[model samples]
Target chain A: MNEQLSMRQIVFMYLFISLSPVLRQIPTALADESGRSGYLSPFWSVFLILPLASIIILLIKSFPSLNLYEIMVHLIGKVFAKLIITLYLVWIIVFLTAKMNIYSLTLQFTLMPKTRSDFFMQIMLILVFYALLRGSKTIFRFSEFSLGPILLLIGILFACAITRLRTDYLLPVSTINLPSTIKASTSVIAVGGNMIIALFFADKLGISLTKKQVKKFWFGAIFFIIFSFVITVFTFGITGAGLTARLPFPFYITVKSISFFNIFERFEVIVTLICILSDFITICISFIILMKLIQWLFGLEQVWFCFLPLAIIVYYFSYFLSSTQFEFNFLYRYIIVNMNLLFQYIIPFLLGLICLLKRKYIKKQY
Target chain B: MIYIFGGLLLISFIKQKDVILNKKRNLVLFLLLSVCGIALGTVHMISPYIPSIAYSLEGILRTLLVNR
Candidate 1:
């Protein structure tokens, strides 16, 4: 089995991971900020996602066969790279905890409303631990195989919901809302920032990418924008922007109204199951990255020694991070989004700037 | 629940005893993380009613950003 991950697989993994945020956060965040024009925010995010995607590709192209940490070391030197890695460490831990909190909260809101969050966390950790034991490639392969069906299901729901779309809810977009749409697009941009995960796996990509591989990167970015657009459109179209803003999970509600020829009802269960699967993959990827960061930070040979303890920490912090949905919502809206922008976009932009400046020296070293 | 957590930690410590004894850095890293996890878990277990750290941070951030 070739454990070396292809660029296409990385794109698949990213799309898989971005599903939860696309489902849970983007629609409501956009609706709250942009009103009826919120659905346009996904399109607005194209300005940032394209550049972020290009920067990721450039970083991989410039520092071929190097992981993010190593690329940082080459571009900015070791001390600053370690400092940046430490910042990533903090960001990832909080991000992981937040994901866990949302996973349990989503379940509580949708299915098994009575179950303690601790039970969900415990079960999720066990599954994540098992996945980690299978190695990183397996996780990527799982996403590669699963993304197709998930997208197909979402497509079917969209087809079913097309008739139910209220044109009044989405139409009459005055010029005034464009600015707010751009602002609200930050939610989409924040979610799309998960593209930087490519750098984490760059070392496994081997040296040099073909044109086809490059196309996959752009394909992933384009797919993200389209996916976000369609999901938001469906939510706004079916559920209406006002209701979407008020509801926590508007896509779930939007799906509830869809039935195949009035025969297959309660498609919301499929939505719930997809969200759960996305959350599981998201958590698994976060753990892999978290352990990788720890290994890089401490110069440790084997990260397995730290995995159990880290899982325990995440288990407890999941509870400590946000005890209720309201707190989680607040944190997500303000702190997490901004933090993601910093780590995912700004830092990578700066790194890319430095990489261009030091290109000559880097070539000499390699 | 706390006892169960402790039991799992103990089982982990036992299973990794070879690396714990041989590798100094791994041992230190392992111990530090385990201690932090145990302490946080115990704190949450002991005072389940206390407001979460996020709630506190949210209050502070909201005050600073919104109120001001």
Candidate 2:
């Protein structure tokens, strides 16, 4: 693992991952859950992420100068560590396919209805495989350079599009049942918990992570999540809740609705650029993390061997994961969201607890 | 399809010939995962559907949802 990095690089990588391809669905899901005052969904979801991120931070601190996989192996037994790593392998496979399916669905609905989605998945995975082979440092470096410009474009677009939101729709927080609202906002876990992926490669970040830094990242993530929510709500809030629930890609539609001086109505390209850049980084970063975990599990010295095989598996599985939009949405709403909670929060919390309780004599077991 | 997977396996094996030939355990582990990938890929190519963790769980959940 390469070990030369600054705080800025780490922060930017987390920011990009925290705001991801799945963000487009959040507002609509929130609207469906919380009804008219759907905007609060981001708040609910991000709120849950703070504690989860904190747990992961503590879990990482427990094991000295180790990556997430090493931390797991130390805290838990080897067999359990393998089980968790295997689960993450399955988890990331679903993550890639979910994003691929959704991106494909987004394209089919918007730009290229005639093109096969499998084509896009294959191309995207191939590019990601190349980046994964190049390794995490290169991807994080690209993230550092891209973050400034992408954030600026996102800010400008948010300013232009948000002016169209009706204050009336944004006033109330939520009028629905509590359980439904929580359920709707579960996707926030996906974004906020993404920082935990960075911990998997923490040894490469050079500096030992601190509580203060984790707090800073949480604040930074909250700021980004708030910005994302505003756009999501404005897109759905001003357009009416029914339309938000109707459209799969309401944020894209919101960008389409933006028209400055009646000249620049088609500003969806900015949204597309942000989505594509983030998706590219996200898919590659995910594969890198998965490959690292596989290496740790199998005691393989060479990760290059596992890279092509796992990438091919991801590519093939992407084709068969979800055949229709309904299946995709159902999987996201029920299965993936719940699973995200289990792995992101429950598992990390367990590890953290074990770290606290275990005596000092429990030296490095691996 | 066989030839394509065969070519990938042979080429990767050739590239890492020293590591593959030197350690039998490493070779077994490498071949096991690679063959699994190839089998899944080939099945996906030939059939309309291939079994996956995502869809299997989806089916299980859907069944639960329908039953409930």
Candidate 3:
């Protein structure tokens, strides 16, 4: 029997991939773009991902048993499909390598002061390699199990920080500058490009996603991301949030700023550990999806063969790209987002359109 | 550092020995990937302070975006 993932597993998959950014530099990037109005960006971004997710689900449903890779090959020729997959693979690997490295760097800065960051990355990668030895299904199951405690702990932290949250931080909804707010929202929406990963396993999700299920899928994932981001933006407020621009991971900074009942202190350690877990989950899943894409690219039956080789490339690239956190910020903020739009949205939208037209032509002929 | 990677590759080769057996193409993909990884890793270890493509892209974006 083909490996089948439950709807919960599928939703959790979207949840982790899309929201992984909340742990790292994405929060400050949002704040730096628009001070007070930055909180609104997540809402705009979630709303943006909805229709795109719907289109992708519909596209997958139209081509029974075929994932995005297979659908691309069926619609376009194999050569063109492989070409597209090559470009898409480069985009994903470079983006994820930065995540792997910078999160390790953030560890060096926040959590592990004495240890080398690559050591952390290597250990994490070993765990990922073991988990992925079977294939892509392990990644989904890991997400299914790992997400519960992470959300619970993060929720407790947010609840504890409630008294510290300043709605005033989100103030003057009208005086909010329009242009920068839009720019910030676009950046946030760029993370929504992660909705495309759902397409990778759309055919294997086991259950057909109904319209309501699709709505729930996108909504649930966006909720975690937007909620965490809103809490962070409000916790830091307009003025205080500026401090996040300098911090490696702003969520930690927000958790540290919180004071619980004037008695408990240093809630940040637990929160940081939990976030590091979430970041690890994100990196693992990214590498897993990369493996799946490579299998499709080369028509290889045993993709596990290339796993170690690709891991080596990923580790090396992570080092090469880890020149500075500034590079991480620049890659995420400037280059990767635009690539997300082009590769994730615009190209797939066109492909779906062509598929629809071809289906209609075939119907008219019959 | 290079020695460390070489050792790691050897370990990976040993672990994948079964998969590597009678698979000429797979061997080629592994060798090519190892070469690419070693080349990049060596460059990074030697320089340790190169301006990445991200910086150049950021410069281009700053010119185009014209943050107002």
Task: Give me the candidate number with maximum DockQ.
Answer: 1
Residue pairs with backbone overlap in model 1: none
Give, for candidate 1 chain A, the lowest lDDT window spanning 10 residues: A1-10
Pairs that clash in candidate 2: none
What's the TM for model 2? 0.89
DockQ score of the complex predicted as candidate 2: 0.45
**lDDT (tens digit, per residue) of candidate 2 on A1-366:** 454655467778877765554456676677777666666667777666777666666655555467777777777878999999999878887887677777677667777889988777767867886776676778889998888887787677667766687777666554545666666677766556676765686666543666666667677667667766766666766667778877777777777877776777787766766777787887877777777777777787766766666766666666677766777877777777777778777777787778777736444542
Superposed Cα RMSD, model 1: 1.4
What are the interface RMSDs of all the models? 1.3, 2.9, 1.9
Candidate 2 runs further than 4 Å off: A171-179, A210-212, A359-366, B1-6, B49-66
Q: Please say which candidate is ahead in DockQ: 2 or 3.
A: 3
Of the true interface contacts, the fraction found in model 3 is 0.50
For all candidates in order, the CA lDDT equals 0.91, 0.71, 0.71
Note the residue pairs that clash in candidate 3: none
TM-score-best of 1 and 3: 1
> Which is better, 1 or 3, measured by lDDT?
1
Interface RMSD of 2: 2.9
Return the top candidate by lDDT. Answer: 1
List residue ranges in candidate 3 displaced over 4 A.
A210-215, A221-225, A361-366, B21-23, B56-68
